[model samples]
Target: MKLAFDRGRRTRAATWVSLGLTFAVALVVELTFADSSKADSPLDSKGDQGNSQVERGRYLARAGNCVSCHTSPGGPAFAGGLALNTPFGKLYSTNITPDPETGIGKWTEEQFARAVREGVRPDGAHLYPAFPYTAYTKLSDEDVSALFAYMKVVKPVSFTPPENEMGFPANQRWALGMWKMLFFDEGRFLADSSQSEEWNRGAYLVEGLGHCSACHSPRNFMGAEQASMAMTGGEYTDKVPSGEIRTWSAPNLTDVPNGLGSWPMEEVAAYLRTGRNGFTETHGPMNEVILNSTRHLSEGDVRAMAVYLKSLPGNVGNIGKAASAQVIEDGETLYNVNCGTCHQPTGLGALSEQAGAKLVGNPLVQASNPASLINVILYGPHLAKLPGPKRWKDMPEFGSKLSDDEVAAIASYVRSAWGNVGGAVTQEQVAKQR
Candidate 1:
């Protein structure tokens, strides 16, 4: 009885100590993040703040790719109607406009910065991970301030965002406090002495304001990123704006032999500048990036990004497997039987008579999974929506005719055949989209 009592007492003491530590840490963090001072900016002066503020805001929006989540296709900018699907549930984006109630009209710079960098809203509600604060945490205070300044001057949106479609347990915003504790780190880019100025700048953009990690990083079971394996992506899923099912396997961005290491700098720049490279095309999440974020960047910035990505060290020793025989064989046979008409045996589809796309050299063949290939086969890629590419390959939707397994097989075949190097597509992957 005495020993049991002592053990219970020890456990209670430990709990108290843990709670005390958490409180102290939280206080330190809150104080450190607090801005002790600020000058009267143009927004504080109570007016339009001039063309410069608006233009600066536009740049900040572009840098952050605000349109990616906030603006639905053919919808008003920052309207907050986009619905993001996640493993836990669906999260609807909020209006960032300056409307007094529905929009951010009442939000101070502090509120905006906290939302952007810390994933907390004006009312102190936690935001869904879809907001990508993990990457935004690295944004400089000055940039955050500039972004808030810009949003304030924009047209106010009177619209209220749709409710988050999450169910019970997952809908609890307080859970994110635990999530943030595990994943969130408040820090800025620290330049390495060994790298060049251009490389460092690229690193800052890709790792910071751009939130490339949102797409590229693999998430833990709790939806936190496994940071050690930074850009070697795992499974990610979504639906395109057109209501066709879409999923993604954010490919490894590190400079492994089969990863970004194979691509030349010019090819990387071309893909970033335009939507297409002779080797592959961007779709799904990357399509948003090209249409909104990357393509709009300066050529110098694009090249710098390419350089920085290329300069990354080879992957850690642990790597996934090559395509299996069963997967490869079934996939190849299906492609030949069904896909030969358009994509052909070589994986080269007739994108256009003069402008053709090669499947062997294509990025789709080398993606981390069969999601893009399956998506393209189900719903043709929309490469022509932007300025970069005039011509694109459009495969007819095979959803009605093809079984999920058949689609998986074909994707698996394409990935393994014709010098392509990526993981095999299981029926499980195909089933997730269907």
Candidate 2:
């Protein structure tokens, strides 16, 4: 996530001119064939004055987790200025507050709907996929109108975000049209007739506003999500409080031995609601998602999401290899000396005391990627303080104490022992995380 603009600009001017002409034609083609239908009628006629519609919109915004990306640290909510670092470039989120000059105050409902569903700005500029409009495009018309209504009423803030620092070709906004043609599919969520009403509701939320796949699914060279491998896990970087960029793995959501196959529906619901199940607790980015989004959802909606997630078929094709026996043995020795007091020799964990999480049958320990497992061993879990009586102390950081080989040994041991099937950790992987 280095700033592309900081790189030396030595390219010939002809290269820019050639790319500009190509993109201009692509933009014209995209706009020519784009759907021109007007937005549907509002769900309610009372406009923003309708308390019920506004309230529903407020809840939907929570489901969308809008503020998490829109607001900068210590800044007004929705007065966006968050820097989103991606492989292609850095993009700053735009202010969504109702400020006429700097936010969405002057945007009409049709303009808002088009932006959310079509990835097109009011002035006809193509928005980068980093906005997750690909998933938002699946939102129902009613939900779109409700969201617009809610946004219209938020307090206005007159802050403008910093300009995006994308590299030469990516800095070309019109190039996004060609990217869309290759991967984007604009449409609303279609309910399955064979599925239960609760299941359908869950699918709508997860596929549309929740935008779960945007994080959970792996992306290709062009940064589009791989449709065939949806939710088998993905990796992304987040800026830690220490200002260092850290890579994190989003575990597979499918029903598999290494994923959620072993998790009960109730456990999934509990985790979403409270950020912890009896077996494991959330840390890092997931903590923010639960705190800002899922925890605020209704009980029925939570259960529905759990049901849908549990129904996903496991991807058996991508299972990892077991760690070497010698590595596991060394790891076990380290675990006994440093971890057994809290985790116990059996790996059952002391949930009542909250000293450690259950490693046996833990989805994270058995994830396809071992990045998060290694991260925890190196940095300790930066577990957020929730509203409850304190039962255990925070896990200490081992980064300063453990050698790269020793850390890899411990990670390899947990990932392969106790019937876990995740891949072994290499000293090289440990060094990268450090």
Candidate 3:
């Protein structure tokens, strides 16, 4: 009986030993596969390959103009607190630094990608469309991974942005899911087989990361971009250095008289690179874009964007109407007194000191919306001092000097004179700009 009991105990011990061995082998196999998967992941492997991936990501970030929205004035880079004023309400940008508590430090690559492409948070909350995730959703996985890798290494800042000041339905984040269902098309860019490689690359950059249409295309009442008017021009409100909210027009990008049709591809590329071409200089929000984004891009990329912009079909849909002969004559007189010295009497513009942009064929002058022209007249050009010969002289602000009627008249004169196709500017429009 004693021998039988001992044998039973040994048999049970053997079974226990067998179970332990099986568990150990299974753990080893699981760990091996896990390590292999990590190594295989582009996010992990490319991130491990030093600064190359990070640098690429940085370039992509610039291309996306991330810093402009993420960083507020006088704030640390990428440490978000910028106030973005939408029609609904004011929304503050969130910190994107690597801070674990306030920023995206704890987010995984998958979470980051999902946030960017799907516009959903790690906690499954929907992001507002103001974040431009609708356009970002077209980002390729590789680019998304690169961006994540770059963000992971950014100097973590322990800062929390102010909460969004949205009212009613706009404040409700859940409604974004329905918004996405209606307007957001979540997918990657598919290169056109018929287009050239450069064209395809341009299309990808312009339509995807650039998100040009977000500003250049008018939005519906629901804040979704109007598909019918893709890039014919749109209006946005900008808060200038002085705590004043100003409305500016993003001009047409389509190949039309009011758009980039008159601009040579090289001129467009040059303008993007240096913020000034032979015709006009970058002002307002475009200053920020050039200073923070396009100036940092590679020549090839800038040229690609120009190519894409130049290729867009023209759609000049009732942008402006003709001014009266008396209004044009009065405007001409104002232009001669106020603007003609810099911009020649013929509107060819002088290249000498105090140079004015050629008003005759200028796209801004011919733009459908005269808000920008009016704003320029009101506030003067808030031009960025880019690296190049300072061809444009500082025009003193006429806001305190010129009446709304006078500003409107001057704008009307330029838009109608020299065969400029831009519509007339009203005193009411000028008053609103003020």
Candidate 4:
């Protein structure tokens, strides 16, 4: 009986040992294969790469809107000194140059792909979502290759930007790995066979590579976008000193009653490419996007984005239009009293381009999103270093000049009379902002 009991104990011990060994082996396999840092570069010289590859890379850069994030204010394009503000803290943009020390210059194509597709740098660091790899995860392997190809040729900037500023519990960088475990799924885009090539291209640009929704979409308390309300305007502020109060909201993009619904596709494309539509010149965060990224895109690419925006399928209420009887009467009276000297009764404020400001079809008039209009009304934007003060977006601040009621009245009239959605505005909302 003693011998039998000893034999049975040995068998149980053997079973436990085998199970542990199996688990260890399985973990090794999973970790090795699921390693996301494999986006290293293919060892090809700039001169060795095909001309088409380089050209395509340039196109992809524009489509992905890389410059918008990397470029510094009053600095070289893609030179990488921009600061991004988040609820957790402020994070600066990094250099994407070929510089060996300061940039991704030495990373192989595989390493670069991992950074773009998986938000893990070649050095095994997790990138902040402010880099927008959430949308980039959908980028095709071929396009990711081309983007790396283009990045390899650019002049490398040697300066590393500032470190992230966050309060305790938020400053922990490794915590992002857990965040990724919850949010990221590195996968390629699956096209719907029924859609036109144009539509597919548009979807790629808007949802996958361009990441327009990062700024345009509203976020929950967790900082993740509310996908259902994608691009439908929300709160934002510039990431500069004390980060200028972004009391001026981002307007909704698909609220037809409030956003680009009344505008035509051609105009949208034109605006994206040139930073101007008959109604308004791009300003606020949009101005940076245009000047850095969209303006560099191909006409075809711009058209594709326009088409996608027009096809959003969901609609929100317009918050810019204010055409009620009281609002319009007050607006016209205010315009004639304060603005008639320069702008005509038609509200087609003309542009001098070389001289003073114009008040014409500024998106404020028909803004479906209230942020742009409210910003201009409350804070008044500056002309900055641009060539002309003649732009309509360069309006002076009227926060001190107009009462909350008056500002609401003028904004209401402008939004409604110009074929706007006629959304109502309240004096209380304006006062709250002030």
Q: Judged by TM-score, which candidate is best?
A: 2
Model 3 poorest 10 in a row by lDDT: 28-37
Please list the residue runs of candidate 4 whose C-alpha ends up more than 4 Å from where it truly belongs after superposition: 1-50, 74-77, 181-185, 239-245, 317-336, 339-369, 379-394, 412-419, 422-434
* Model 1's TM-score against the true structure: 0.80
Q: Give all candidates' CA lDDT scores.
A: 0.66, 0.76, 0.75, 0.63
Candidate 1, residues 301-385: lDDT per residue as tens digits? 8898888888776653223466579878888888788777666787766666343356764544565655666776766554435
Greater lDDT among 1 and 2 belongs to 2
Could you tell me the TM-score of candidate 4?
0.74
Rank list by TM-score:
2, 3, 1, 4
What's the CA RMSD for each of the models? Answer: 8.4, 8.6, 18.6, 12.9
User: Model 4: per-residue lDDT, tens digit, 17-134?
Assistant: 4322221111100011110111212323544455788778877886776765676555455667676554445667778878788888899999998888888987798776767788
Tens-digit lDDT track of model 3 for 1-434: 44545887886555444322221111100000010001111233324446888878878988887877777666666777777665445677778877899999899999999999998999999876657787889999999998987887777778898987766545667766766777788899999898888888888888989888877887665567778889987767764433367666778888887788788999999988888888888776677677767888899989999998899988885565788888999999999999988888999886666767778678777776788788778777766666667786777778889899999999999987877788888999998888
Where is model 2 poorest over a 10-residue stretch in terms of lDDT? Answer: 28-37
Q: Estimate TM-scores for all models.
A: 0.80, 0.87, 0.87, 0.74
- What's the C-alpha lDDT at position 398 in model 2? 84
Error of 2 at 420 (Å): 0.9
